[model samples]
Target: MPEILIAALSPVGHFGPLLNVARGLVDRGERVTVLSGAAHEREIRSVGATPATLPPQGDLDLDLLEPDSGREEISGIKRLNFDIVRLFVAPMPHQAKALAELLTQKRFDAILADYGFFGVLPFVLGERSARPPVLLFSTTPLMISSRDTAPAGLGLPPSTSTFGRLRNRALTLLSQKVLLRPAHKAANCQLHRFNSPELPTFLLDVGVLADRLIVPTVPEFDYPRSDLPANTRYVGMVHPSPTMRFRPPVWWQKLDGDRPVVHVTQGTVDNSDPRRLLQPTIEALADENVMVVATTGGPHVSELGFPIPHNAYVADYLPHDLLLPKVDVMVTNGGYGGVQRALSTGVPLVVAGNTEDKPEVAARVAWSGAGIDLRTGDPTAKAIRAAVREVLGDGRYLRRARELEAAYAQRDGVAEIAALIDEVIGERAVAP
Candidate 1:
């Protein structure tokens, strides 16, 4: 069996899916080493991969990035810029150094990097002959610049008309040249330090240059890119984190009772403020006939810092594998993996997230006919209730969700990804 190196960021959304892939590779008898933050050490070992923590600069605590108590968190383009610079660009040199040191210590057959792990970029941009094959995977929205759609953060839907294409082109230029120029320059500064070539295109588009760009969802869920690179492959959602051990909560059986179940989550990384999505969702369904199940993502139930309503059930965490099957509708901040998981279970959604890649995820859900997008990071209770009612009352949403469920059933993401890895390694071995 081949030895593989998996480089992932610490956030659950990014690390979880790649962890599934690592488990699959390990089960098949490959030796896997995962480089990430100290927070994930136990889980990395639980999945049978050796854990290597990033250096001090790269081992980031995502929660600390949040605003202090009573202070409001930034949102929209400003937040996006903050993330690109602080979370992505700022950590590049440290990540690159960690990977370089690891390579000096051992010769692995291949490397797997999550989309946000820009540390692998030095190798990706350097002479291909100097490094092992690097396979890049995305756990979020496909951010590659496309003529069929506007820039990723803007949340504009795909357009095929001449005017729409022109609009996409115009916005793409403005984003790359004006809005995101600083990120581009910051990335190149690190590249200069590493003596690697500067990125030839926009930073997000650099994934297409990898040995293989693995997108963890079916083509139907993502916007079609007529100019999509050949190396980009739509392997089905690598799902069901096998390591997630679920013990039903005390009120879990309520899902079996008469009322329909609606699940609301702000996802794990951005749930510092319940007021953003979960709190409003709880208030939204307080009087509805449906039962509302809200998760604070990871905070204690008391950390919600508010009174739970009669119609609501709050938990600090619940495994989606067990909980989603009973959910009739999901209200979320549109984390990409969670949205795909819901669609796979044939559950429709009400998405109200605007931060990060969430707006794009919400747009895809609406475009796929599987959900309603409230179009705000902080949605009003009225907006939440209305969207939930629309998703629940409409038969088209369920039908479309079921269609996607069947599509998900036809493919196995881990198997496909493992096969791609083997193929990349085989080709590398034969290269002159």
Candidate 2:
């Protein structure tokens, strides 16, 4: 059996696409082992792969990932850069060592890793003899250097102005030098005992070094840039496993009346102040002719102390595939998965909250004319109401979303990704 190791950081929202890919590889007669945090063990085992647990290095909190937070008291882009380096970049050595030990025990043929796990590549791919060919997987849209696409995680516009160009150049330089370079060096140094080659930027050094770069998004949803590396290929979106089966409550039938249904969910992680947003949303649409379906994702739905309007249904989670088709508008925190789901269903969006990569995703949603990206701070009830009304009243957004949906439907994501994996295995002769 050809053995493959799949490495992921944690069991958060990003794990789904990578898990789906691993499951596909396992189904293809490859022996697959998953290296991830303890929280993900059950999820890994559910896919019929052996789970190798990494020790708890405290909790993997998303708050630590946001650059804007804590900046008011603290100043300087360099300080922010140092914080990111300390929190994320400095952990590469420990992660690389753990992954290296796991690989030695299993003697795997190749590695399939998520972008966050790119840190492990220098250790796994550096030494010619001990090293195995690698494949990189990105759950989100692949970023290209040339076109603005939607701004890499910020809402910054595409630059022609000197200041914008300088800002862009500085950010890119800082990312390459202070962040990626050090992590790559750390991993290479850890593998120096085996005479591993020095690595460059994790994306280019390992991506070019890798046999293939598998992006789990379709070309239709994201336009390909001419500057994309030769090794890169878009494999379409990996449909996530349904977390829980949803049976619409009896009151769901009442929602089928005259009003159009609007679905609102802030996704799992980025909804820290769900009540702050959800309450206002419920109140804003109370007198309106729209029916709202709000998902609190297991948090207290009544935290804002607002009365639940008769027209709104509140729940912890809703099966988006089932619910999206029935919804005319989606209000969310701009999680890529949920946004893509809504777009696939031909429903327009009202995006709020600028956490994580959300501001960038929200900007894309607005730019595409498929939705409105409301500002996170001071997102008053009036703004939510106006955005909701605009999406529902204007037919253009729906038309644009339907256009994207047609494009999405034409692409067979699963088949395309499966074919790519088959080609990779065939090229390397790695099979169980």
Tens digit of per-residue lDDT, candidate 2, span 138-173: 655555444323225556545545676577667666
For candidate 2, the TM-score is 0.84
The CA lDDT at 37 in model 2 is 80
Error of 2 at 324 (Å): 1.1
* TM-score, one value per model: 0.96, 0.84
Q: Which lDDT values do the candidates have, in the order given?
A: 0.89, 0.69
Strongest candidate by TM-score: 1
The prediction achieving the highest lDDT against the true structure is 1
Point out the worst 10-residue segment of candidate 1 by lDDT: 63-72
- Across 61-146, the per-residue lDDT of candidate 1 in tens digits comes to 46446666212476545566676878888888999999999999988999999888898998998889999999999878789988
Against the correct fold, how does model 1 do in TM-score?
A: 0.96
Shift in Å, residue 162, candidate 1: 0.2
Off by over 4 Å in 1: 60-64, 68-78, 242-245
